[model samples]
Each structure stands twice: as C-alpha cells, then as structure tokens.
Target: MPGVEREPEGAGSARRSLAALLLSMGVSAAFAVAFIVVVGLDPGITFALLAALLVSAASAYRVLFGSPRRAGGITVGRTVMAGALATLVVFGAIQAIPHGRDHTNPPVVSEPAWDSPRTRELAAAACFLCHSNETRWPGYTNVAPVSWALTDHILTARDTFNFSAWEEFPTSARLIEAAIRDGRMPPWNFRLLHPEARLSAAEKEELIAGIRATLGG
Candidate 1:
C-alpha cells in the first residue's frame, strides 16, 4: 500500500449533504401543513399557502445554489428551514386577528306559549340552542373565525323566530315547519355534534304538525 492514490472524499460529502437537505425539506413541509391545519384555515387556503411556501423556498434554494449536481444541498436546507420559520410567523399573525370571541347568551325575555310541552321540548332539543337565549356554548364556539361565523349565524336565526322573544304567534311557523319537514331545521352540522337533536321522519312530521298547530295554522 505504498502511495496507491485514492479518489478524494468529495462525492461522499455531497451525498451526505443531499440526504440532510431532503430530510430538512420534508420536515419543513410537514410542519407547514400541520401549522396551517392546526390554525384552522380551510383546505383551499391551506393548500395555497403550502404551495407558496414550498415553491418560494425551492426557487430561493435554486437561485442561491446551482444544480443539485453540485453542493447545492446546503442552500436548499437553509431555505426550507427559513420556510418553516415563516409558517410559524404566519400562525402568530392569524392568532392576533381581532373579533369572533363573544360567548355570551342574553337573558330570556319570554318563551312562546307552545301548543304542547312536547313541541317546546322538541324545539329545545333541535332549535333552541341557536334560536333562543339559552344557547349552550361548546368549547369550539370560543375559537375565532368559527366563533365569528357561528355567532353571526345564531344571531340571524334568533332574529328569524326566537322562542326567547315570544311574540303572539310566530310568522315563521310555516317556514319552521317547512325546514323541519325537509330536514333542514336542526341542520346536519348541528346534528353531527348533538345527536339528541337528530330527528326521525316520524318525529319530523310531528314537529312540523305541532309547529303549525301552535301557530293556529
């Protein structure tokens, strides 16, 4: 083994750098996705932001360092790492946005004189949460954006035909009956969480009939 010239260690170093670079980029992408999801952005926006992050980071890496055939992996790794940090910054910015945190339920003025206690009971189970002042705020209702949309919806529903306010006879009786008949009163989203609010065909008919009866229709 006297002066047998060995090939330099350049290729091995480059291979290791490439491996580390790929690992960093994969981790960055995962964090960006998780961050976007956990912050509660809808799928469309989340995907858009993710694509932007990856493309921008990739382009930046390519600009700073030439083709991967060279030792460009180090530059790629740095750019992806920066992208992950940028996602965290975006999360913080979203959290700082104001509005959609009100969790108060106003006092019940007077309830409707229902045709029967069963009618009131059914309404309580299915509709009163949003349509009355007796709303039971769940944990997610406290979160932003969701809270914003839900509160707005609740306010609008209450305005439509609030059992809490209780006028002489609600003009919404026909609309309410129609919605219940069509399986839209409680809403699928509401039933998803409160299974008790789920209505059967027979029960829907009963609710519709009772609402019409209550309104003297």
Candidate 2:
C-alpha cells in the first residue's frame, strides 16, 4: 500500500471529465423529460424516475462509503442465496392470492340498457389505442421512461377496465362518463398520435349513452 501511487487529477483531465459528466447528465435528463412528455404527462414517469434515482443513489452510497468489513459480509454467494430466498417468498405469496382477486373490481354498469353497438365500437377503438390488453400501439409502448409509465397505466387500466371485456366492469357507465367528462380517458398524448381515438362531442354523447345502456342506467 505504501508503494502504490495515486493518480493526480491533472487540470485538463479534470476539466474534461467534469464537462463530459455534466453533458451526459444533461442529455439523460432531457431525454427523460421528453419521453415523459410524449407519454400522458401524468405523475407516473416523474415518480418512477424519482424512485429509480433514489434507489440508485442509495446503492451508490452503500458501495462508495460503506465499510469494507460490512461489504465483505455480503459475499457473492450469500447475495445470490438471499436473492433466491426473497424471490421464492415473493412468488409463494403471489401464488397464494386468488386469481384476479388481487386486482380491483373491473369496471361495470349497474343495470343493462339497450346495447349500443356504436358506443361499444367507439370505446373499443379509442381505449385499445393505449389500453389494449393484447397489443398496444406500435412504437409508443416501447420507448423508455415513457414505456415504463405507459406500461403501468395500461396494466392498471386494463385490470380495472378492459374494453375488450367491456361487459365485465360493474361501474362501466360511471367510469366511461368520468373518463369522457374529465378528458382523462383517451389520454391527451394518445390523441396527438392517433387522432382517430380523439372523441368528438357527438362521439362522447354516443359513448355516454352506450355506457348508460350497458349499465342499465
């Protein structure tokens, strides 16, 4: 250890390294923001980024500042074993939960009214743009950060209310009405890409009627 020579931070090298780091950080942050904006601009991407950063920072701190003795305690073998056991426990707990019971109730209509084929068609067309249970819109769902959030929204929305399985939701009418009235259902960014999904005044009315009929309102 005494003979080891530490590399000195030369002025030019230090400046170049700092500049490169700053540039990289700026580019990463910009990409993150742009990706999120392209998505719904909802709280999802921001929250996920915050969570990832926090976890990353914590891991970095542990790696950089933790005592060597403690670090040694977590040997590769022990780490693998711990990870395996944790995964097993998680899988077991998940298996114990009843199928579909882990999720919230699917959207439903209270009473059945005259079924409007138009409304069902429109809802299927619009909702599937983002909430498609089988296939999502091309290229949209694959982008990073944006994909992260969109994937979550898609899964949650599909679980709560999948238009493909429209008849299953119990409060389908109320959900449809709220989604239209609040202008939150179609998702603003989704409209930008697929204008067809954007609901017009007449379309919204028809959609509401359809939802009402389905729910027996």
| lDDT (C-alpha, whole model) for all candidates | 0.69, 0.56
**lDDT tens string, model 2, 59-158?**
5434544642444322333333433444344434444434322223334433234386686578766776444344344553444444555556666776
Top lDDT hit: 1
Candidate 1 per-residue lDDT, tens place, 72-141, comes to: 3354456556565655555445556565566678788888668999988888889898889899888877
- Candidate 1 has what TM-score? 0.61
Looking at candidate 1, what is the lDDT of residue 62?
59
TM-scores, all candidates, are 0.61, 0.50
Q: Output the worst ten-in-a-row residue range by lDDT, candidate 1.
A: 34-43
Off by over 4 Å in 2: 1-29, 40-114, 131-134, 143-146, 166-169
